[model samples]
Target: MRARLKRLLPRTLFGRSVLIIVTPLIVLQAVALQIFYGTHWEVVSRRLAAAVAGDIAMIVEMLARHPGEETLAWVTREAFARLELVIRLEPGAVLPEEPDPRTGPAEAELAAALAERVRLPFRIAWPRTERAVEIAVQLPDGLLHVEAPAKRLFTGTVTVFVIWLIGSALILFAVAVLFMNNQVKPIRRLAAAAEAFGKGQDVAPIKPEGAEEVRLAAASFNRMRERIARFLAQRTEMLAGVSHDLRTPITRMRLGLAMLTPRLGEEDRAEAAALERDLAEMEAMIEAYLAFARGEGAEQAQPADLAELIEEVARKARRNGAVVTVEAEPSLVVPLRVDAMRRCLTNLVDNARRHAAHVWLGAARSVRPSGGAAVQITVDDDGPGIPPEQREHAFRPFVRLGATAGAGGTGLGLSIARDIVRAHGGEIALEESPRGGLRARISLPA
Candidate 1:
């Protein structure tokens, strides 16, 4: 029951806020109306019915005392002129039958009053002329007919009360919606800023607005973003310094190895060459570390042709003697840091090309599970695929799978690719490719 109610409730803060405000108001109005109808309305209606009934009773008493044509004419004129009632007398006539049962409060009240005050058998015809009630009272001489306006027994207060209640509710609802919209706007801006920051986009601090608590949250988010930026900057600077310091000695050693190469014996030259290769590999590893630390590196996202970027990566792979095919539209664009995304795609393609003979790159528009537009890019290769269990392990830093461990490359390829994709508020997953090898799938918001 609780879960069902939760599902039925409004999902947004603004909608829920309106419900919280209006639900109680509707309930209050309902209760107030119930009270009015139960007590005040009924009392007023009974009093009005009793007054009309008393006038009829007085006329009947006068007719009983003075039974003459002249007196009957005077009574009829006075009733019409004073009470706005139409009266007539039927000589030697009897009532045909009783009217239908009274249903409404005013009809019931008027019937009860006539039974109490007039003490005569009567039939009341409601809405006799769309605005009157015809009452026929049985008499010894004839039937006394009285047609009174329906307004005499029914007060206009109920209509006025209902209109006032509905009008006030409508006005209050309009005000609540306007106020809630204003309060929610600042929160929406804060959320957008947070999402952009998480995606490593350059988002300015949001202005504090709306309620005090919301403003405080905006201020806190700004402070948190500043701290994170400072931390990343410090980490990047430290890694850069380490890369520079290590490269200086490595460069000097390479120069020294080149100088001694010609002077060495054949076997010694071969050993020196092996040493040079090892030195070069070390330098490559250091550069990879620096690249990983640099991350998005102060780059702001802008609308770039995603298809063109994929084609550029394919061209670079082809230049390196790898067979690459790109399947993408001509003008698919999305917001991304060009350099960072290029490096990410390059890493994925390079890893695939190193192990596979042919590489396939494709991009297309897609929809996320949360119903958002996204761009999907796939890097596929026709080589030995990683085990299902080990696919996730491949994304761990420096963790290489056994099948592709022989490929001469740092294990950070997949890790770096995953990092860059996630930094763009996208996702990267390893799946089976149609080409019978690994597929690196990246989904970014469009």
Candidate 2:
């Protein structure tokens, strides 16, 4: 049953909003109407009956002015035509008895209203009909019994109440929709804030300006973001300082080795050459750290064809004797931080080249099954593939396996590439390539 209701719900925000607002209003108004009928219906009917009794009193007061009983009855019927009013008097009490059953439905309704009261509009019911001879039976203390038809009076009162209920529900529904929209605004703002944070973009603190819970959520999110930003800043500063200092000492060592190049023995020269190789590797590691540690770049997003970017990266790899091929369709533009995305794609292609003899780059625009345009770019290589367990593990910074450690990588390449792609609202994954090697699949917005 819950599943059925979920399926029936409107898929769009506006439709859901309208349904949420209107459904509760209709139910509440219906409940209120039932309550009103249960508690106050008798009171309203009694007040109406009392007014009818007053009119009947006036009729009795002016009865002497009439020429006869027949004329007086005619006058009474005409006066109470629209309302279910009854008039029957008992000996100088100056009020009507309850309506006679022989009369109409209106009279019976008026008579029923006085059923509980004594010495007022007297008791009335439909014990018998068809005998138009209206009876004025005597009760204790000069009370008179009266009866009339009940069906018409019941119908008339119900009609009026139903009209009132419908109008009240409509007015209430309008007010509810307005308030619901206002209440939902903060939720929408919170969602947008989360999306911005996901993209590594700066989201301004949303003042929880709605209900107490919404305000609390916004405050919590803002506080968490501030703490994360501070942490990232301090960590990046420390790494940058260490890398810079290490590079200075290494530069001095490289110069000292150069100064001894002429006097060094064959084995000593070989050791010095190996030391130079170590220095170069350290330099590369520092460069990788600098690139990977950077956060969201303050570049304006612009539409660019991801296929074109992949092709350019592959072309650069080809010039360096790497057999990289690109296959893609053109004119598929998506919003991107161009510089960061370029670095990310270049690193992935470069990694492929270092791993495999043949690199193939392919791009295609695909849509997610749940609905969203996704651009898929793949870099496949024909090298020994990583195990399934290690595929995801290798994407982390500074994690190197047995074979990859000697491959001249800082191990930050894949991690930095994944980070940059995620910042653009995209993802990267590793899978078995057709070449029996690793295939890197990157998905971005289209």
TM-score winner among the candidates? 1
Residue 22 in candidate 2, Cα distance off native in Å: 4.1
State each model's CA lDDT, in order: 0.91, 0.73
The collision pairs in model 1 are none
TM-score of each: 0.83, 0.67
- lDDT tens digits, residues 1-446, model 1? 99999999999999999999999999999999999999999999999999999999999999999989998999999999999888999988888764555778788899999999999989887864489888889889999999999778887889999999999999999999999999999999999999888888878888999999999999999999999989988998798789889999999999999999999999999999999999998988888877776777588888999999999999999999999999987788899899999999999999999889999999999899989899999999999988898899999977878967778887888888888999888999999999999999999999
lDDT, candidate 2, 29-148, per-residue tens: 688778876667655655655554555444444554664668657765765575444545455443354444446534544665444332244334445544221324343334343333
Any idea how many clashes model 2 has? 9
- Runs with alpha carbons beyond 4 Å of true place in candidate 2: 9-24, 28-166, 296-300
RMSD of each candidate relative to the true structure: 3.9, 10.5
lDDT at 381 for candidate 1? Answer: 97
Q: After superposition, how far is residue 62 of candidate 1 from its true place, in Å?
A: 8.0
